[model samples]
Target: MASETIVPPTVGDQADCNEVNTCHVDEFLYDVEEVEKLAKKGKLKRQYCLDCNSRNITAYYFSNAGTIIGVEMNKECCEVQEKIINQYSMNQNRIKVIHSDVMDRSDIVASSNIIVANVLDFFVDIEKHKKIWYFFKQHIKKGSYLICNRSITDTLESIGLSEELIDWLSICKPCRQENEIFFDLEDFMDMHLYKVN
Candidate 1:
């Protein structure tokens, strides 16, 4: 969101995106109930969704007190999402579909009161994913929330995760680390919600 092209070269530009649409499932619905619970506690505001789809866009449209910025790297994804939003007439000034790498938009990330990253495993490789975590740690404002569907403890071939990042954000729900998503009743993945320290 800040001026100029200071995007990290991974999902930063079109080339790195491989011109291949990395759009995946719209599984944010699974978290909608939990998010609504959190919002009822008056915890949500200015949320950002990374590599997001339309489901969460509608889910978050209610927070008139906040803004929703959906960041996607694929042009087609953004176009499709914009069309969907327009069709729903979510024509509010608070919603934005940004066509750039989430890493490139530090200003947007920093300002967000909460972040929803469905999953980064499908979008980038392990190394790039690690870098993105580092970038998030660098920019996300303290006290903000980071809601991701992957474990921060998940590591590469012997690449240790930084204790600093772990120490910086404590999981809002310890049980989330154990909670698994069932795709056809099979364990798919774990989900986590964190509050930055």
Candidate 2:
């Protein structure tokens, strides 16, 4: 399937993502159906989705297939989030938003099937990044996935973290595949998929 053809968002501009303090979900043009197709085809990884049998690792941490914990540093966009949560009320329990730092949420790390940490560069600092990685290493179970918008190396470098001292390789490994996984939906075009090693 062609990756670039996305349904434009009804509200706001995708280019303004960097300028805003908090980006609304509808800011970027994301075709949910296309994204699902990509996930099933093994070309991309989708969060809170269990029907993608093509995935190498089955996220076994969650009891219910639709249960997802959405962790955020701030409550800047509560209204938008509420709208998103309401959209998922039909088939399963909607997303549960945890208003706190990701590192502090040990309960979340322990139970979530796939932790989608999008735009971590905006919220996490250097020291927190190190602490969070260590925390994740200690907590997140094997076989579960971590989907992030920024590269692990880039996140470290952005925080002035020295890779020699802190070895993230021991904790998690990148999802090994023949071709790169690209999510063509909205702000997720450059996202990478990783697994707990």
Candidate 3:
């Protein structure tokens, strides 16, 4: 008799649309005008946002039927996501929001062009930081960009985490001038961008 075969699900297969449809989450993040704008610009593709920024314009491109792979979206970050989505109503099909825990999900690869990890410091322990870095390294295509943010208090709270973890998140504190609201030197918030090569 032949043995039964068991196969693990692929990244595409593991994502269950029935559990949380994109539209439900979309409604929470976007409005009519914003959606229309995105459609008009033909910028709707794959875009990610950690902390909202005017420079995060890749979202406009991805939202309009462009191919956007991964987005590090949290329930609290939905507002910014909606604002970007609302810019393009016709291209909503280009977007997919994965509601999984960013730190723990192994399915996410480095194939994404834009990786945004906003306020992620709040959720992870120090030991897991290297895994996070390696995870990003694995999935991002060469020359792809990674965006990350961390709050000071968020970092302090992360002290309970491992030393390696703190080093990973604290590598680059974004200049306050670049990000007025989210990047404050004294406040313990930092944003970084990395190009995968």
Winning model by lDDT: 1
> Which lDDT tens digits does candidate 1 get at residues 1-197?
23434433475455443212332213455376766665444454323355652224334343545679998999999999998777557755778899999999999999999998767777788788788888988999999988777765553222456564668777775443255532332243476768989
Clashes of each: 0, 0, 32
lDDT of 3 by residue, 160-188 (tens): 43443333432333544643454345554
Q: In model 1, which regions exceed 4 Å deviation?
A: 1-60, 155-159, 162-164, 174-190
Steric clash pairs (candidate 1): none
lDDT of 1: 0.68
Across 1-197, the per-residue lDDT of candidate 2 in tens digits comes to 34444453545865433312222233255577766666566555444233643434433333446666677766876555766555433322455667888778898798877877666555666677667777877888877777777776676676666464245433343443667553335555566666766
Candidate 3: C-alpha RMSD to true structure equals 20.1
TM-score for all models, in order of appearance: 0.57, 0.51, 0.39
- Mind sharing the TM-score for model 2? 0.51
TM-score, candidate 3, is: 0.39
Error of 3 at 169 (Å): 14
Q: Is candidate 2 or candidate 3 better by lDDT?
A: 2
Worst 10 residues of 3 by lDDT: 16-25
Over 4 Å off, model 3? 1-65, 69-90, 103-108, 150-191
